[model samples]
Target: MTLPVDLETDAARLRAIMAEDLAVRGVLDDPAWRAAVEAVPRHRFAPGFYLPGEERDGLGLTVWQPVTAALDPGRWLAAAYSDTTLITQFDGDEPDWEHPAERHGGAPTSSSTLPSLVVRMWADADVREGHTVLEIGTGTGYSTALACERLGSAGVTSVDVDPYRLERAASSLHGCGYAPTLAVADGVYGYWPEAPFDRIVAACSFRAVPPALVAQTRPGGKILLTLSGWLYGYARVLLTVSGDGTAEGCLLGGTVSFMSARTHAAPAFGNPAHWAAELPGEARDARHGPERITAATEEAFHLRFLVQSAVPGAQLATVGDVVHLVDVVSGSAATLTPDCEGGWRVREGGPVRLWESVERVVDVYEAAGRPGSESFTLSVHHGGQHLRHPRVPCLPLPSPEGRPGRSRTASGRTGHSSSQLARE
Candidate 1:
């Protein structure tokens, strides 16, 4: 028979090693944070996580196998301490934290984010000793515990849409002997009871900066989150709430992606042939190829972000060498096919001329000399929020460009298909 192992001793050693890696990699320069990183046991928060197994899901996810400390102390402890993301929720289904599962196909619904990233974002948000923070997406509550360590549990308020998530987080946090405020509420609205926070940091991504977050943040305070859309493009932004009840800042250069706010989650995309059959749009030769916006190349990645920025609710569908862009709301749609002459043919219809507007944005992007996201700024003012280069003309929000429908707007989710609308 195998003898039982001392888990706490091993966990402490792993924590020390993880802290050392962060410091050496420049992710944990703050001495206080480093202390917290070493002291807080992430394993207590995320005792089990899913790892990709032999099977694969076509959506770039995979067949995940659950690992828990009770089943395999060594592997579970290793995953808990690693610098990578550990999924705790699988496709909205909770993982069995004390059991082992060999394989199951599912997308990631929630996770313990990468430790390095967690530390980096906290540092970027400039979390300090006296700051009262509002943490969006409690998830595994690991980051919440980290903040509690550095700033004290009294100053931290965490919120999640799922009550079960909050329950687990509260339990795990209590296990760590720290009790920060945990709430079950939609993060989009911002936790009002704890208004005027010194820092509001999000683990989940949003289509735009939450207006409620702007109002609840004290003037000159910071709000950090990743902005993403159905196209699956992402941009990390750090906005400072101004005295004028507005916030604006440049996009952080690195790429960061997150699952949608459940309220904003989209459905799996389906065939566009039926949609095209319903709306026979005007036919014309197109100057630009839609392939440039959908390709997986790095250069195309930037363009994909720009296109998603320009058209918030548009969904992509590819069929038989043709690419389709459909705006679910307004019923606008565009289909593009490569022409025999090395050009592209297009058909677009509805309240908005989808392809025409896309071409215009691409034109403006090129005219601006193709500035990287670092040079681009995100402005959220009384009029509306817009992401664009300062010197360049505004990238018009959807409302002004076309008529509104029931589709998901930047302000909130009317909802759509993640498969159809969201890029993998």
Candidate 2:
């Protein structure tokens, strides 16, 4: 049997690391933030075991230590202190204590987000004392603890979908002497029991902001969340609710990946083999227009965004002068191989194919001057029913210059595909 690890020593080291980092980063200047960071013992919230190398090093290196499979206090402390995500689930499921190995497989479904990200989010939300806040995604209850520390337990309400996670987190919070109302329900809907929140923050990422979250907040209340997109990174947006339940916030900075809430989870792509077997030979070598088209430009960025928005489950990859689009839904992955002088050939079943729906995006970009991200505008319409930004008027097809055409289209079309969107 594995022995239990010591918590006190580990907590001290973690405290030292966090304090040092905060001091160096100038985050320690905020008394409230500093106090919360110091007071929270991250290990208490991580009850399940984690391998030695599982922790994030914060320098683009992920060390996986499987030899020491069971949780260790020192390792846990370091992991808790680092600015990296600690995986809490595998294959859309949480860890099963009896089967420790099962915890490591598949994509991480949940985690106590990195400390830096959490702190940054709090900064974005502008959390203040006495403010009533609703926190979405209560993984390990760490962020909820911070909210509690900042706003007091009575002032914060947290919601999550997994009852087991909620129950475990409740115990951890109680053990640490902080108790907030914990609800085991979908966060996308927002907790109506604590409606009219002065501030709303989501630790999880959403493909699109749910109407319910906007409606539940009081006018002038702010909503902070990581908005998932096709780009390599996500945009953290901070919008304020209007009296009419509409909210608009600017994209803050950078991105982070989070598990999609159950309500917004990506649909599973059918068998890969099935997709590989269904390609027509002649259709495979379709023509992709020009080399300048795939080049990144502000205008081209808008075209790319349109393609991503239109096609659900499509992933873009640039390989050795060739661009590939892996369609998760149809199980068809296409590759567009650029010919010698910037022209290209489409390869179905590969990453990019010209005639395929994926290459159409490249054609659109080539048509555009390849503008940067600054030139576009994003607008949400349908009574705040949809998010259409960067691309004008939210139309499906591109204009002659590869820019999104006019808006004012009909209200509802179910928005973008959930599969292509990632949570942060």
Candidate achieving the largest lDDT = 1
User: lDDT by residue for model 2 over 1-424, one digit each (tens)?
Assistant: 1224555755666777786797688656677887888888776776554443545566544444421225444555566677666776655565565555522234666777878778878877888887899999898898888778877899989998888888888988888889798899888789998788989999876666777788888899888876543332244568787887566655553435566666555554455445435655543345544333344543343344445544545555654565555555434465565556655666565222323443554444445554333343233334323333342333231121212122221233222232221111
Clashes of each: 11, 26
lDDT per residue for candidate 1 within 1-424, as digits (tens), equals 1124577788889999999999998889899999999999888888777777765667644677778766777998888898989888866877555555654556678889989998888998988989999999999899999999999999999999988888988998897789898899999899999888999999998777778899999999999988777667777899999999999888887767787777666544456886677666457898778866777666566777777766666778777788888876555678888888888888876656577767866777788787788887888888766766665665533332122224453435443211112211
Q: Candidate 2's error at 151, in angstroms?
A: 1.0
lDDT (C-alpha, whole model) for all candidates: 0.78, 0.61
TM-score for all models, in order of appearance: 0.86, 0.74
| Model 1 Cα shift for residue 37 (angstroms) | 1.5
Q: In candidate 1, residue 72 scores what lDDT?
A: 76
